[model samples]
Target: MPQTEHGANRRRGRDETEEERADRMWTDLIQEVRVAQTGVQILFGFLLTVVFTPKYAELSDTDQTIYIVTVVLGACATGALIGPVSLHRLVSGRRIKAQAVRWASRLTLLGLLLLLATTSAALLLILRVATHDGFVPYLVAGVVAWFLLCWFGLPLWTRHRHTVK
Candidate 1:
């Protein structure tokens, strides 16, 4: 859909009807979900194996608590990332591609947020355990701030800046 000066974009591309647009959006949403899903799955896998490591027994009570929190966060992230696929599978052939895309987009956003939290918690746990310095929290905070700026802040700013009134 090409935007003209009068805000008329024909509501679609030259070769695409509304249905086609919805279908394309659905495919794009699924592809994006796959990328996030892979990361969450990998992180969850690693977290699951952590408890069986010999170092797990040597962790202090606080480190152990952090580990538990991190693992739970990873689990939540995993669920959120994989949610869109299940949503699409259940809703297939229901003629709801537009609605499905909206729901999937929402799920993807939620998954990104969960991923942020999971990554932050994992970094905290790893840094604290690897180097019991007071700067671990600060370092993790810095990294989380960077992620926030890149993942959420900049996109929001661009959306607000470019949106027509």
Candidate 2:
């Protein structure tokens, strides 16, 4: 039994070493990235087709700008979500699982943030085109709030509340 720094058995039933822990974390991260990558890729694919639609020309200049920005953000999110695969392929068998996991986590975070922005912009553009109302900002704000809760607030709260010392 390995004594912990607090003079207790540190092993929590699974006596995984640092490398093994990193490998586990890496797999979990990859699974998470896969979910986000799939969503962003689908969204990016749809956004890419919007410009070819006849309705695109009917959009106001402001809405056109919003669509452009949203598409760009979606593209960025797609790239960020897929970055881990490229990173792993390039660094395969490099004996740097910990570093790779860290990088992948960073990329995933970036991807999520970009996804949030992309979704928000897309919602705003769609609502403005569909409603043409003065309350579009409020609608977009409410949707953004919901997204914040679902994507970030809940996860962070759970992590903080349940993480062991």
Candidate 3:
């Protein structure tokens, strides 16, 4: 690319400074996190209520253990998903928006990973209890594969294909 008068603008197609770029990225990141956080919180809320239900007491020992683990994963996912808001509250005026945004992005990614695990485990437990069929594991595996492909594979492939060197 030939050097334009606005050299940086020529490359990025935006005539924005570092702080401006950070602000824009932060806004976009927060919006994305908001959607993920809402879903995780709702799921976690449901997980909390499961143990209090009558059906919970009838669960097999293995299923109960799975329930316990799923709840823990849900809690972790909730915490990770909410971490960025707390991070913003504390670090808002620190003049390190770029660093804060990086940390927030990492937390969001971890939250998504935890959310995936929680969802898969919850699905496995539900299927085992509802069907008692030998194919429950296979069904859960297929769903998990779909989630992985939608959540990670496509985004990564697009990033690899489109990102400027």
List per-prediction Cα lDDT, in the order shown: 0.89, 0.92, 0.94
Top candidate on TM-score is 3
After superposition on all C-alphas, the RMSD of every candidate to the true structure, in Å, is 3.4, 3.8, 3.2
56-141, model 1: which lDDT tens digit per residue?
99999998998899899889888888888898899999988789889888989998999999999999999988898999989999
Q: Give the residue spans of candidate 1 off by over 4 A.
A: 1-17
RMSD of 2: 3.8
Q: Any idea what lDDT model 3 has?
A: 0.94
Q: Which regions in candidate 2 have their CA more than 4 angstroms from the true location?
A: 1-14
Please identify model 3 stretches exceeding 4 Å from their true place: 2-10
Q: Which prediction has the highest lDDT against the true structure?
A: 3
Q: How far is 34's C-alpha from truth in model 2 (Å)?
A: 1.2
TM-score, predicted candidate 3 vs. hidden true structure: 0.92
Number of the candidate with higher TM-score, 2 or 3:
3
Clashing pairs in 3: none
Q: Candidate 3 — number of clashing residue pairs?
A: 0
Q: Rank the candidates by TM-score, best first.
A: 3, 2, 1
